[model samples]
Target: MAYKMPTQKYSGKILEVTVGSDLKLGGESVLPFYGFDGNIGNKPAIGMEIWDIFPESWPAAVLDVFKDAADDPLKWAAYCVEKYKPDFICIKFEGASPDGLNRSVEECAEIAKKLADNLTVPLVIAGCQDNDKNAKLFTKIAEALTNKNYAFLSAIEANYKEVAAAVGLAYGNIVVAESSVDLNLAKQLNILITQLGVKPDKMLMNPGCAAVGYGFEYVITTLDRIKLAALEQNDETLQMPIISPVSFEAWKVKESVVTQEDIPEWGPQEERGVAMEISSAVGVLAAGANAVILRHPRSVEVIRNFITEMTE
Candidate 1:
């Protein structure tokens, strides 16, 4: 006898967002990879990260991957695109940190313009977390890439007004509204951005994610709630696609940093670090993230294979 599939139905679908020239993300009518019951819309995109300045303190496992191109942002991005082949490139403005390089906003904007001009894929431009700096940096980037239409990393409730206003200046650009692990905060931030004249389709959410061994469950639970609110509760405010900077947070943990020499029982350093990132990426994707920003090439390859298997 043939068996029937037990499927779950959703009342609402996540909004479809087009980035770059023609890349479309999100638009799923059910939970992730439930193709038998609903549309997967688009495959979850991978945004490979490239820092504007050489990441001096990055773990060897990550730095070694970009060793040759670390000094040049443009080349680094190109190498990531050509070699690693992510769906998009996310240029992180780590140089602009107040205690760091304190690179001028204009300088960062210049880099963004050059990357946007040269790359064929979409760009995800992330600014420094400092609200004041991000406000200045995002505005300058918006003006610099005015006609290019790239997405900006974030506009939080604390400073969404300035960032949203600046990003809204670009016709096809979108903003990631970051909130704490709280669902209400996520919804509220989305509402605030839409109120700033940005449409709901032009937004993404980043409810803070944690590394696998620490608060990883928090990331999954929070994402599940946000997705449920969007798909089941039919909360229009929470319907936009979500992004998880999996590698960004995963690499910061002790598991990804501590050398095997320091702790002989931790197994191999590179393998351990990769596992942490891969586990986090898998968890977030299953929880409903539309895309994940990754740092390691191996992690990207693993996640891509996993996605391919699930979709197939």
Candidate 2:
């Protein structure tokens, strides 16, 4: 008898989302890129990370690469797009944080608008987690990018009303609903955002990604459950695409932050950092990540290669 392949059926599918000029993400009928079983609407997309201001706390590994471009947000983003050719660009409004530069909302809005005007690719804006500050920043940024519908406004949790309302007022752009590692919390957040008048398809879930060595297993397991719920139990509330903010979590760990001199056993600082980001990203992709936001151009290249190999 001829050999046969077995595949499981799924009733749920990921929502397809478009950003920037023509960047499409999600819409998968199977987990990740299991094309043998179902349709892979679009290959997982990667967005290289940039910041509104120079990241002074970044180690030499990351700092060295963007030293020149760091001084100017526009220039830095342009460099990432032109040089790295990422599927999209993600700007972390770290400067708006209370402990950071404490940049005014107006200033942050101006920077976001400038980047939106310049970058032809899709943009993802992640503001600091301060409820009041982030809500204000998100409102301004959402308004600024309303026309293009090119930006993804991050993290409508704990402040779902304020941020989701901002996106609603803007009339365009996607919202990222975030939750802790808990699956129920993740689902509840989605429901809450949907109730606020944001369509479920227009939202993406950030299910609390942690780095490789930092509770990574918990993240993997949580994501698997979420995917299973969506596919097996036909959970409409959980069918949205999943986006992992890989860099921020990865860089905070000891393995990624420590210097070679500080930890001799660890390899070169640059290579170690890239490995951390890459490992975390790959793990998430395997567990069912539809989009990954990353720092470190090298890590981006590596993950892109992995995605191509797996999908092809």
Candidate 3:
């Protein structure tokens, strides 16, 4: 069978960032660089999320996956690493922030240290939603893990440059800069982080994620524009890699969490959750995301396999 393929051409190369001392988050050129005729130097890495506190509000399907280790962050992280074999672990300091559980900074650092020592793969430590609280949390962890060189700091937002600067000073390899859906805002935050002496290769930008049927189009457009600009050698903005919290979007969707009783004929909740993760991931890859923070070991396995097939 003969078919016509689009002969589109792209410019510039995807930037690569090595996470741990031995791990390489390699550069990839071409959207969803897994397909034939594209260039993908590194396999897209998977990161599983571990929270300090068990999320009681999570849907049954998700809660079941973490049932045994929900209350224990270290155990959960180890379990995910052992089971899913993820490339890294993203330890979410959900309740340890001032606006949340308000745990002491020392305690947060201790938890991060535990994960760092227990897991061999790279680590990502994220603070609670509050900017002030996260800044304080990341600062402490950044200092504690300075010598480790395997941990990536959660974020440095427009309002949190002080914390980001502290992290950069401590030699953290990666820091996430988040902005609303605005591309300019995303670029501006990246610039702010770089101004703090952090190199372009060490920064990751997340424009925030929206669930399917809930502003997903806007998220896609934002990511597409950002990638397009980067391909054109928009040096200031295209120099860093892009990350997306794909699981966050899927877990929050009603179809992913609601029971059949709440919405009959929705099929199995677990299957729906997996589907949501896959759809969001595929879309984000098309938009030029280099990495993703995901949950559910099953979904990670599926997505990794899919990426492998595409790259082959």
Candidate 4:
């Protein structure tokens, strides 16, 4: 007699989204659901991070790559496109923050336009850490790039509901929600956004990722719970596509920055940085991540290959 395997039936619903002119999310069942058992519908997309101003405080390893284009957002974006062939460009308007250089909204908009013109892929515009400032800046960029379809405008938090509402009304691609590490809070934020008229299909969740040896386990656990809830069809908030900020986690860890002399046993800083990124991204993929923002081109390639294998 031959042994037979039982087929697993996934209860969760997958959201389908067409970004810009070419990108599409194919609908399928299963968590972290690539196109394996069933049709995943969309291939995971990668976004290279580009800051509005020169990152003088960045780790030496990161600084070394962007040394030439750090001061110019357009040139930097073009470099990422030419070198990495990223699926999308994620531009962070750090210069517009109050604590930072405080570049004006108009200036930020100008930078966004230049990048949009230079790149053929879709764009995701993120404001600085300040909610109020980000709201104003994000709105300006959304309006400026209206000609480009499928641009993801973010970070609609609890304090910036009004701005989020405006972006929703504009019908531009938008990312709304929070990183509470709590399932209820995540759902509540999504509910709030929907109440304001934002469609569920257009929203993306960022539960946030902590570095390895940090609170990574907790982050993974939270994401796992969210994914389980979504798969069980018990929570609609967790159903939307998820975006993991992998680069942010990689850059913040001391292991990724400290020199060999400072942390001799930790090994090379460059290797550490890459390891941090790959580990963080792989962990999130297990939990449930449809998109990821990364800094290094090598990590992106490794992750892409890993995802391809999983789906195969």
* RMSD (Å) of each candidate, 1 decimal: 1.4, 1.3, 2.7, 2.0
The parts of candidate 4 lying over 4 Å away from their true place are 33-36, 147-153
Report the lDDT tens digits of candidate 2 across residue range 1-312.
998999888888777877666877788878877889989879999998888888887889898988799888899999998989998888999899998779988999899889888887878888875767998888888888785655554655667888887775455778888888989999999898888788776788898899987889999999999998998888999988889999989888888888999988888888888889999999999999988988898998899999999999
- Clashing residue pairs in candidate 4 are 26-41, 26-42
Task: Assess candidate 4 and give its TM-score to the true structure.
Answer: 0.92
lDDT of 1 by residue, 181-208 (tens): 8888898888878987898877788988
Record all residue pairs in model 3 with backbone atoms less than 3 Å apart, i.e. clashing. Answer: none
Error of 4 at 41 (Å): 3.2
Q: Write the per-residue lDDT of candidate 4 for residues 14-97, one digit (tens) a residue.
A: 576556677655255666653444556576778888889887777777778777987888888888888888888888888999
RMSD of 3: 2.7
Candidate 3 residue 288 C-alpha distance from true site, Å: 1.0
How accurate locally is residue 202 in candidate 2, as Cα lDDT from 0 to 100? Answer: 72
Candidate 4: residue 287 Cα off by (Å): 1.1
Q: After superposition, how far is residue 80 of candidate 1 from its true place, in Å?
A: 0.7
Model 4 error, position 269 (Å): 1.1
In model 2, what is the error at residue 301, expressed in angstroms?
Answer: 1.1
Full-model lDDT for every candidate = 0.87, 0.85, 0.75, 0.75
